[model samples]
Target: MSASAQGYVAAELARGGYQNVHDLLSQACATHPQRTAFSCGDDHLTYAELGSRADAFARYLRYHAGLQPGDRLALQLPNCLQYPIAVFGALKAGLVIVNTNPQYTAAEARHQFHDSGAKAILVLDRLLPLVRAVQADTELQQIILTSVDDLQQPIYESQEDGTLRFMQALRLGEQRSPVQREAGLDRLALLQYTGGTTGVSKGAMLTHRNLLANVLQTIELFDQPGLLEPEKDVRIAPLPLYHIMAFATNCLSSVGMGLHTVFIRDGRNLDETIGAMQRHPFSLLSGINTLFVGLMNHPEFRRIDFSHLKWATSGGAPLNSEVGRRWQALTGAPIREGFGLTEASPVVATGTQLSPYREGYIGQALIETELRTVDDEGNDVPPETPGELWLRGPQVMQGYWQRPDETAKVLTPDGWLKTGDIALLDADGFVKIVDRKKDMILVSGFNVFPNEIEDVLMQHPSVRECVAVGVPDARKGEAVKVFVSLKDDTVDERALLEHCRQYLTGYKMPSFLELRDELPKTAVGKLLRRQLRDEASAAAS
Candidate 1:
């Protein structure tokens, strides 16, 4: 099956249609001109309208902003109509996109902008102050700003520090001649920054072929079971698009399939998220465990109609078995968990509708993708044995931007990219991610995985959210520390410890546990275990 899927992907690409990301957009627009491409709140854009606006932005960047092909353009906006316009326009203008998180701090923003050497930035007005704080530190020559309602309503232009409003830029670009640049498959298309969980964030350089191939690979998998129908499926995109997973899935794959995507700017806002669901009656949905747990806890979640829902996906982090079971029970649709890192264009393995759901398994690798589990010595591990996961495929990135030394650490010269994840491969070829390689806890010379501890804790009804990390212990070398937020205040720490004692071994049990109002997480709802570990180490010191 893997070999045939690889052949099919190669044949599909060899047939020659959409050579670049912009070409993908063009094809979608031509095929579904009247269909809705994207929506946020009450504002939406048809395929044709999206294409026209993207073209205008492309022309504006080339003619007005004076950006050349291969130049970097940073997009720092939430999920809104302007995001697609900026993304497609930047691609159309032959510019590489640097997707910046709107919630980034000044230091984080400065690092990404300076590192990417972005020539221009399209930012949301609310975040202009943060941009202003970091713009002088970057090489940015142009600043294009937009408000949430800029596309839906007219607003007077604010010429603050020679910045151009998003709508104004579009209007001005429409008057200029169209831009026609040849962006080949090998040309770099994106600088997707990884979460600096290990250290400073590094940008993973993705090319046109890398993204386009992943899109084709994903479409092939979805098409096998008729899970997605072009111009028919309504996908709810509540995750931040700046993240690689969402970018590849929602921005690239969904567009290629001509699926209507409803963007929820803030998934944390339960009211707004539930409202969007009420409005769209979506057929497809994607989210993380935190989001699923939050929605299930909300009263409105039960009221929203899930009749049209055909498929659901979970990624960005491991899906707790309890959470998955609850989600399936509530929606009548099982959540198929997938796994990937930014270096692999954010998708390597995902479960298809044809595959039976398995707890903790991320199913098989995508078409044209290869997977390996290896020991620390780089030798292949036995099947079903936990080791570092290695992948090789079209979706693997070219390398880290301007960081060959850093790139060499993860990517082998033989073309396999070390995923830095501890995983196991079963006889059926299913991949089960155990935990991050760096996050493993060593207690008295025994290796303890935090995902195992957290998964067990999540089965307790009183545990709302939790993360387990290894903290310093003079006696044990390192001890398990579990941090949790509760759903029921009646359940005390003793009860939680007793619950853990029932499921965990003596060495695996938490030596220290702390209750928090909430845990730290990335913008995409991934737990910040590294941060918690750092804090715990500091406290121990």
Candidate 2:
């Protein structure tokens, strides 16, 4: 690591008030006791109530469930009141949190549970069948099932199948006092699973210091003049909290700043999500490209008042420039895009309120973070040159959990993380993420980035969603193939190809175009290029 980077990180941590993630909640409770901290559907929790309930859940883990410090606890629930309670509670009990996506299949669930060696899990009641299917193959000792309305409904103890209800556990937990456990800043706080798109998902081991530093870094960047206000801004959180972006931003950073976060249980359900926005008059919104497109297309979206919306953020995937422009036209707030991976506590750079809107740029690096673009030989590239992006900062993860071989591949011995993204840094220090190094398509010996193609395609009025992938070609080594889902049946393949030819060069233009009802995306709304590539290769074979 660079000496300057280390000095900056040390200084920031020294002045940062809290030591652990849960400590942020404690301070928020003390400072903003009566303010609403989190809400879902019709249920909400004041800062004080959230803290007390978290303490109760912590007591239940320690005294009732016999969970001890350093134990792993998997939280497998959607956006609900129990999600935040379980997260804060698990952290308070000195347990490492494994944020499991509730959409995981039985095999995926089994692999993560067995790999993390999770001793307990707080799962949604509807997902119990999948958990039960995989329970015998893993190290899970305790099962706590919860419904969407667990906090509002009456408690029911169902120990018949060796499972405990969420409300019942909280009720039993209230009988005991809070557990007093000392958590060092260096101790592991969360095992966030990532990299599933490439292969098997690996858990990124984030320490208390890593998460806290990111929270402070984000707060420093966004806390400009006339920007974010504490205890006043209402944030609409439609993304799943299990993802590292939402976990670091909404669950930790937003709470630390005393923001009232309204959770949308199912972001895919546009009606419910739009309804939440209409009801809350949220000042901040965070989402990816697909969510933004879906919201803007919804008939009810324009009905909601956007005057209260101060700023919006986009991540998880590249924000199409067309989408950003349309969003700004519809709502007065500009969609400031950010860049990060799960390893850097998920946020390395973001656009601030004062920053100018630049197409394909992800703003500047966060406070105390160092960013560089390195060539294939690991030498620094000049400004405006594209190379693999490298980051070194306090927010970087300790390492991947129990995967030293995998850890050695990404993290350097000198503490710099080799982000697999190809990016360009201009003379002004603004970053434009070219593409993921692995995702770069080599067509006729020239690098064709999917983002460049997708960006051009998205500008077409009829193109609702589009993705580009490299397919096997007999003449050239590989060829560009485009998949698109349109707004209507007005345009055919010839028209789309003609549209692409107008903007894209001959080499960058699509050799083949396929139209579909919709393209496949991840739960977080990232386009699945690998899946499409695999299908294309299979068809050719």
Report lDDT (CA) for all predictions. 0.84, 0.84
Report the lDDT tens digits of candidate 1 across residue range 1-541: 1623556656777775656788878888778899999999998999999999999999999999999989999999888888888898998888999998786667668999999999899998888888888889899889888898897795548768779888889899999998885568899999998633344568999988888888888887866546667767899988888878888898888888899999998876778888988988699998876677778888889888999998688887667688789888989988988887788887898997788777878898887888889999999989999999999998899999998988999889999998888899987779998766777675543446787788789999989999998876644557889999998798988899998887665667899999999999999999898899999989986
For residues 38-105, write the lDDT of model 2, one tens digit per residue: 99999999989999889899999999999988899999988888888888888888999999888665
The root-mean-square deviation over C-alpha atoms between each candidate and the true structure, in angstroms, is 10.3, 10.4
* lDDT agreement of model 1 with the native: 0.84
What lDDT is reached at residue 491 by model 2? Answer: 93
Candidate 1 Cα errors over 4 Å, as ranges? 1-4, 195-198, 440-541
Q: What TM-score does structure 2 among the candidates reach?
A: 0.82
Model 2 misplaced stretches (Cα beyond 4 Å): 1-9, 196-198, 440-541
